[model samples]
Target: MNNSYFWLRCRCNEDIVLLKDPKSDNRSRGKAFIYPKERSYKTFEIKYSNKLSTKAKFILSSFNNKYIYYAIDDLLYLLKSNPTEKENLLTVLYSSILALHNNLEINFFDIWIDNIYINEIGKNNRFFKVEEQSQTLTHITLTLFYRTRSPFKKPEAQW
Candidate 1:
C-alpha cells in the first residue's frame, strides 16, 4: 500500500513539526513504530493504527518545545554519500559485537539499523554542525533496550 507522510505543527508553537501518516482504513497493522521521518518502517506502523488516539500519540506534548528543524541531517544520512564513513560505522558495530562475544547474548531487531539512532538531549561533544552552527550532534543518539529473565526456577521454600 502506498502511504504518505505530512507535517503537523502544534498550536502552541508552529515551529514544532510532527510527521504524521495518512489516515488508514480497515486494513491496518496493530503495531506502531516511532522514529525519524525518513525511517519509513515506523511511519507505516503508525498509519496502520485505525484509532485516532494512536495517531495523536506522536503529537501530544505538555511543553512549548519546537520540533521543527530547517535541516534534520545526521550521520546516518551523511553515510549515504560517504562509503568510507559507512564502512567505518559497520566495522565499529561489528567490533562491538565481537568484543562482547563471551559476555552475554545480543539480540538485534529484524532491521537493526532502523531501530538504532534516536534523538538525545543535554550536553554533547564539541563538534559543531556545519549547517546549524549553533547546534551540535545532539540528535546523533543511540539507546539500547534490553530485558533480563532468570533461566532457572527457584526451589520450594523451607517450612
Candidate 2:
C-alpha cells in the first residue's frame, strides 16, 4: 500500500490549506493506499454538522484573524510565558475533543503539539472573555488521514 500526502494552500484562503492524499479510493485493493493517477483531484470542504452547538461555534470563532498556523510547541511556549491563558486554553482543547467525539465519532489518537495548531490572534495580549480566550488559544485546523474501520473497535470475527 502506497499513500502520498500533500499540503495545499488555497489561493483564496491562505490561512487554511488542504492536507490531501490524491489516491484515496475505498474501492481500490488497498483503500486509502492506491497509486496516483491522472484523474482530476476531488476537493471537499469539511463543515460541522448542525449537531454542533452554538456555543461551540462561538468558541471557535474567537480564533478568527489569529495567525495562519501555530504548532503545539509554539502554543506551549506562549502559555508558559503567559500562564494566565492556561485555563482558557485547556477549556478549548477539551471542548474540541468532545465536539469531535460526539459529532463525528472520530477519535483523535494523535493529539500532541506536532498535530495541533494555534491561531495567531491575541498576540498583543489583549483581554477577552474566558470562552473567547479559550478559542483564541486553541483554535485548530486539522487534516486527518485514517482508515474507515475503527482501529479501537474489536473485530466482529476475531481470529
Candidate 3:
C-alpha cells in the first residue's frame, strides 16, 4: 500500500511512452504503471486487480520510464554469469505470490507468460568478493510484477 507510480502520457505504436508523475500524494491518484502488451489500461487495472497488491505493486512501479530493455539485457548477463545471486528476486516473487492468494479460497490458475513483468530498479555498486566465475558488474536490481487475468491460459494452449 506504500507504493507509487507514473502514468502513461499516451500509447505510442507498439511502445510505452511514460508521461508524467502522479501530481498528488493521494493514495489512488492514478493507475499503476505496467509494461502492457495487446491490452487496454482499464483491462489491466480492473481485470487484473487481484494481483495488484503491495508486494506486486512495488514491482509495477519500477517500470516508470523507458530504457528498461537495456537494463534487462544487463540483468540477464549478470544472472547468467552468477546464478547464485537469484535469491533476492526469488524472495520478492514468493512474497508477491503469497500476497496474491492472501485470505483467499479460490482456484489459482498457472501463471501466464504475458502477465509476468520484470523491471530494473536501477543499480548500486557495493562491495562483494569477486568470485572466479562471476562478473564484477553484477549490480542492477530488479522488481517483479505478475499480473492476474481470469482463466489464465498458457500461450502454447492458445495456439
Candidate 2, 31: how far from true, in Å? 21
Which of 1 and 3 is ahead in lDDT?
A: 3
Task: Show where candidate 2 strays beyond 4 Å.
Answer: 1-73, 110-148, 151-159
Distance from true position, residue 106, model 2, in Å? 0.9
**Residue-by-residue lDDT tens digits, candidate 2, 8-101:** 5677756465555756745556543232233111111232212323443344444432221233234455455445454445444556545545
Arrange candidates by TM-score, descending: 2, 1, 3
Model 2 accuracy (lDDT, Cα): 0.39
Determine the C-alpha RMSD for candidate 3 after optimal superposition of all C-alphas.
19.5
Model 3 poorest ten-residue lDDT run:
41-50
RMSD, every candidate, angstroms:
20.3, 18.0, 19.5
Clashing pairs in 2: 66-120, 66-121, 67-120
Instruction: Give the runs in model 1 whose Cα sits over 4 Å from its true position.
Output: 1-30, 33-78, 110-143, 149-159
The 0-to-1 C-alpha lDDT of every candidate, in the order given, reads: 0.33, 0.39, 0.37
Q: Write the residue-wise lDDT of candidate 3 on 11-128 in tens digits.
A: 5645365444465455755654454454221112112211223443344334344333433443345445334433344344344434445633212232221233433232334575
The positional error of residue 116 in candidate 3, measured at the CA in angstroms, is 4.6
Clashing pairs in 3: none
